[model samples]
Target: MKRDINIFEFPLNLGLKKKEHEIEPGVRKLPDGFRKFDFHKEINPQNIFRLDAPDYSMEIDQESGVLNAEGIIEYAKEQADFISENHKEDAFNIILGGDCSILIGTALALKKLGNFGLFYLDGHTDFIPAHLSETAAAAGMDLAIITGTGHEKLTDIQGLKPYFLEENIYCAGNAETDDDEYVQQIIHSDIHYFDLYELRKNGFGKTAGDFLKMVYSKALDGFFIHLDVDVLSDELMPAVDSRMDDGIDYTNLREILKPLVHSPLCFGIEITVLNPDDDKAGSYTQPFVKNLIQIIKNKED
Candidate 1:
């Protein structure tokens, strides 16, 4: 069935540690930034929901050892509740994130709904323990938190620990393979891992096809996609918080996303880590907004 589209804007950016020169991460501007290029108008979503985020801060929680842990948990609960209240089975949700940490709330909401698979596409694995994190930012280790590998406070929200099973997730497009420790962490986990080199070697379309097979084989209730724009090459999209050298291009992006976006059991996608503050001229964001709309619009056709 072709599902209608719904957009949810959660502009919380507290998950990131403020850089030395900047006041805070600028990911919070993502939703409005896309709208500036007519992203929302082209999709013409069925409904629009937005949750205003708290002002940015860089406090490290003593209890969880994560930056802004308390604020992240607070917003995550509200995000889950908001999504639960307005969720529609037949509508595809396009969650515009404040950062990668927004997955925590959506994971919680999906947990309440039923077992869900996750297709994680990012420039980093995001599967490190808090102790190993250089920044102590939740965005750096969200995959670990959601999979019950962190402090109980963030991982076990309301006793729903392990929002997503390790084996049920497919983490693709990691470019940070230079660090053995960082690479080894996710390698030890059950999530199916595909670094950027391996992703291209296997072929983007085939990699996505393989993930779909897993979703069907597991008979999951539905699945959510996490898209961190840094997965695109620095040449193509360099407006992200962390810029890696080489990554996929727009053609490769559509090759991977089209099948998944059009799938019947797919829930929706969340876009993260695109800092509009860096792309003041909108050169990168313009093409991003255009290609993404076409990918979604093709689903209806």
Candidate 2:
């Protein structure tokens, strides 16, 4: 059976538009400037998944504070249909996003097949609820939704919880500004987190190796790796919405991800929040996508 890789392009910015009470009024009033980036032009077209039809769509309801959860699920069902039709073959859903919120839809689609673990690599905890969020951005709540804890529409994707227990989730390279409530939740839950301070103390290679061993030991049938580019330092990857200087460098980032990509148990991967408006003559963003393609191609070889 041929291995299928589908790239779902999601470019909506609804999550960024939502206002959060916790954020300072000054930050909340800032103009929406991140949307100007052209992700389609920055990414190498040849490296992405090709489709006979459009692979991206969106619908947002600000009054209800519900993102296009229904539309996302519908698109996910389409991807599920494709998987059902091609069940004899191995398939991978590579979701390239408008923002991180799209992970909810991808997770929903994967849940229909069987159980799977999640590898959430990001700079923030992304576990904030809509009401408690410092910035009520839907992107910030992606992980919470997948873990079965946020808005009903989000957590109830496909009418089933899409993720494993909190213990099954793993976070790599996060910053210090994470919310206190979210931090407490992580401590109480089984989720594993590797902060920048910890990475610097242990070394990226060692930390990644340890994580891989731990993930493989869990006996999960499959796993999905979600990469939020903000996990990289601002110097290396400046195209993300949440620009922060405190993240892993490019070399270390690659070292951490290489083993996961090579693992047979990794069913799919998603790369989110690549904003071209912040890109430097397209020089900074292209290499990352190229490296990702190389990693996938290496697996093929």
Predicted model with the maximum lDDT? 1
Q: Once superposed on the true structure, which residue ranges of model 1 sit more than 4 Å away at CA?
A: 299-301
Q: Which ten residues in a row have the lowest lDDT in candidate 2?
A: 24-33
Per-residue lDDT tens digits for candidate 1, residues 1-301, read 2589999999989999877878789999999999999999999999999999998988999988999999999999999999999979889999998899999999999999999999999999999989999999999999999999999999999899999999999999999999999999999999999999999999999998999999999899989999999999999999998898999999999999998998988899999999999999999999999999989888432
| Count of backbone clashes, every candidate in sequence | 0, 4
Candidate 1 similarity to native, TM-score:
0.98
Q: Please report how far candidate 1 places residue 55 from its true position, in Å.
A: 1.2
Q: How accurate is candidate 1 locally (lDDT)?
A: 0.94
Each prediction's TM-score against the native? Answer: 0.98, 0.76
The alpha-carbon deviation from the true structure for residue 33 of candidate 2, after best TM-score superposition, in angstroms, is 17
Note the Cα lDDT for every prediction shown.
0.94, 0.62
By TM-score, the best candidate is 1
